[model samples]
Target: MTGGRLSHLAPDAVLTAARRVMARCDELARVTADEGAITRVYLSPEHARVNRLAAEWMREVGLTTRQDAAGNQLGLLPAADRDAPVLMLGSHLDTVIDAGRFDGIVGVLMAIEVVRLLRVADGDGWRSPFPFGIEVAAFSDEEGTRFGKALLGSSAVAGDWDDAWWELEDSDGTSLREAYREFGLDPGRIGEAARRPDQLVGYLEAHIEQGPELDRRGESLAVVSSIASARRFQLVVEGEARHAGGTPYDMRRDALLGASEAALAVERICSGEHHIIGTVGQLEAFPGAVNVVPGEARFSLDLRGEFDGERDRVWNAISRELDAIMGRRHLRWRAREVHSAAAVFCAPLLQDVVRAGIRATVAGAEPATLFSPAGHDGMSIGALTDVGMLFLRNPDGISHHPAESVAGGDVALGIRALAEAVAHRGAERG
Candidate 1:
């Protein structure tokens, strides 16, 4: 549905535009490492192809496009003045293994659509009427599937670059430094991608809900309250190995069993907290054989919550449970935090703007507000500017998997909300 102010662009027109955006996302999904599945890692050939396609679309909408030093695809719609403050809109382009088409791709495509709408009205005074420059960025990596650290692209832009990251290697043994060179990007020039906080007016990202909240509420779109704080750990459980048939139940010190209990403790502890989530996304037992008792177990822990203190509290409870389980089983455990990021709150002013956009698109309904449990490029961008997010409904709330989906009507409404947000913000600034 189109807002009254934009009724000149009818529902059919918005639906047609949504179809174009979805079609572009599907086309780019074909650029993947696996022949039968989607897997576009950072700095891979697939990454380059998708970036090129996005850049072309950006140019078609009157943006001056380029690949930043860190390999982020950027398209700029220059303001009347060269030094005007900037407003950025975007999401990452990379995907996890067997990922769905809409997860990150939808944000980037919808950003392009927003710019397209603005460009189409440039002749009608939208060009000279804005006080800030608009940029559409398609970040190269957010999943961090290849290097095990997320937000490489946005982190660089936030000026959080680390020299040690060059040493990170992919599953195929290609170093991050080597990949940069192969992609024709100089590692030393990464700093060129950084932006000063004063240069940005704000940042807005439109993305799929990636959860069931919006669908359950029967709403097409919602404004994000905050991005969840998260911590990840690599846990190793040590125990004794024995022949499965020869070891008595009382004498066995099965690492796998201890790990199983620890994983359960994580769930039990987290389930008691509000808006907290814990996941054992990966687990492996050593000497994976049927006849051998597990001597060692390694697993990954991903803990998240709406607030930092609450998340840490749950983590502590889980750790205490693990210690007790290890002691009872005559086992030892070790944990190392692989990654941690603080929660980011949406700026109140930006949230208000997004709410107005949603209200306008839906004809004055009070928009639902929710916190994002999944990480996004906004987590990094938040370090540089006030950040806000708009989440479109994903019918099943399933993400990462191939079944993740978005309805066409939802996409149309999302585009309208985003475009209206830009207009609303511009009018306020004017």
Candidate 2:
């Protein structure tokens, strides 16, 4: 990317701006990642401190600063036309439990870079060519790891806000309302969080490729096609408790067997062709004794697929496994759903723009698509307005962990792609 395609600014200038922002954000993310619980991260001071810094930077960029009732950080880069729909570029700032730095970080920072490029091309002035304004939003709590609600801020902005989230609590039992009041945001104003139905021209987000596909294919960019639906359940299995030394192996029904069988069923349910998978990421057993048979067992099941029909088919298969395992083990069990997300299709128009941008950086960028097993703010917004996303090649396809990484060159290429997309969109709508 020599900036030949943009013709408005040098690649070095565009990349320098993005890298500078990333460096600063990396520090804040390190601090946020210090917390352990998913939902607990947003309730911690780490989130507050980061919010303050984001506001400060927003002011520095000459955008009007204001916090929504939901405490969504809004930095308004007003275009010449105030009456038409505005374009929003951003993603969530909150991370999952023990998360990595770049998941939502790239989207927020790249948005700022997009603004800088738009300003540069709008004639190196504080002006925009498009009639619609641009605002970079750092959605307050897109990762509802704490509140059991994901896409919090973006949902509100998309007019998909849910009142059910107000009752959410952390492990210690602290409610989201309590945390909100402490941060000076009144929880009662939650309704004010809604963005006008026609307020946004479209939305865009950039996130890490938390899977092996992009790296495996040797591609630096992924124009997301759809976000997979997710279905999760909590499984509890029970078996007879007996003395380990006295109880014969044949006489004792093992709870762990039920759990193990369930785990295998998840994998067997869906073949890799449909991108379906079920995982038992957490588990527990009760009673302390070297000789005693386990009395209780519990685990969590996470399932996802690229399409609804496929996901349903997989879930049915999982149910069949559970029945066989429980009956064979003579164990009483219960399974309860924890959460679910329907698959989301990214806007093709936005995907084409992102493809053009990526084409400017790397070869082999087909106008193709991949399904995201993981959820994102883009999923919620895509349902309401035209939305698209870009993915950076993750070094190990790792995320939600500190060791997660992506190459700097790939990051620079992602930035170039975003710049190209923003310019293209601006041109189309202008």
Candidate 3:
């Protein structure tokens, strides 16, 4: 019952499934808030539309579909034993502002395709079932695009919903609770989305590498080693504003100059460390007039690493450097912690299954292994179940932008590997 012996997974069938996934991604891309760009957010009209479309596709493949109270779309195919715990596969469906088509969309569609392939593989036409049930979840708010807090949907599913989040608002100033009501979901019933430990086997997700490692090595797929530990901050620098022309260079305390130095320090320190990344994604200076020196400056820092201690160490180093820069410039600076998540390592059993699945595709080649720096719904779902991920090659590793791309051929191989992984997992359970 190894993945290699799954005779029904022929090349033509896998390619057809891949093409369908690509087409479905295109279809989902159109159901967005912006007409010209993809911008679907949580609990919006676009969310409802995509859920309906996903449900329709789920039903077509003989799955029992439902939208949970947290607005996640779910579909289930039962096991031979009706009461058995289920193995789940899926990723988020929501998109960031002007997002690429396949960040989370492909995983959901690929999960559906896997189910279809499984049904075809089962010669008895649903009579012969696997040892565990299978479920695909299209989580509603992984991007946190509207609310500014990521993993809202998966956190609810993981039973980690925070009451404080109810007060969180979008750019339009609409609170989460109000949006929930508007989306036809009762805010109080969101707890129903949570799943207890005994009711599941594990979770599996497939996503684009979102980095150049795979594409650089000429590899089509890889097994993820772990998701990185991350910390985000909003940093502010303060100084006295003065007339740019009137003030002498020695007397001027320029906050913008201090902030720029700090940004450069982040890159310098992080570049010297292995697997540690630092990004200054946003920056702004106040009273932005050409003749006036900036009185204050604000910037964001997103720092991540393979381990928590190393990440914090880099942050501490960056902080020291920032202090030196501000002191030398006669300015003051501060940082506010906005978000944090611990590293999540993949389960060994799941990793083995994924490796076997990849072997089924490439025959003799060893699957490349990588650690993901990008955050995902799995970071939240890991609280509920063991999580494993497979990475598809993304050209140039571009993601979260209009230019993100994945090849149809690579997607075809991803489908076969994912289906084989499910089969291998089933055999293990038996």
User: Which has the greatest lDDT?
Assistant: 3
Cα lDDT of model 3 by residue, 1-430, tens digit = 4433476667999999999999999999999889899999999999999999999998888788999989999998888776888889999899999999999999999999999888633443341157788999999988888988889999999999999999999999999999999999999998999999888889999999989999999999999999999999999999989999999999998889999999999999999999999999899998888999999999999999999999999999999999899999999999999889999998888888888889888776799999999998989989988899999999999999999999999999999999888888888853
Off by over 4 Å in 2: 1-5, 33-40, 120-125, 271-273, 363-368
Who is ahead in lDDT, 2 or 3?
3
Spell out the clash pairs found in candidate 1. Answer: none
Ranking by TM-score: 3, 1, 2
Clashing pairs in 2: 39-145, 39-146, 244-291
- Comparing 1 and 2 on lDDT, the stronger one: 1
* Cα lDDT of model 2 by residue, 1-430, tens digit: 2322576667787668767666865666656534442322564676677677777776666666677877678787777765777778787778877777777877787777677666623344365556677788888777777776777777776677666667788777888888888778787777787776588878878778888888888788888888888888888898888787887877878787678777777766665446887778888776646677777889998888889888888888778778888898888788898777888888878887788888866676474466788888877787667888888888868888877777767777887788787767776743
The local lDDT score (0 to 100) that residue 224 gets in candidate 1 is 99
| Worst-scoring 10-residue span by lDDT in model 1 | 1-10
State the TM-score for model 3: 0.96
Candidate 1, 329-351: lDDT as tens digits: 99999999999999999999789
TM-score of each: 0.96, 0.91, 0.96
Task: Give the better candidate number (1 or 3) by lDDT.
Answer: 3
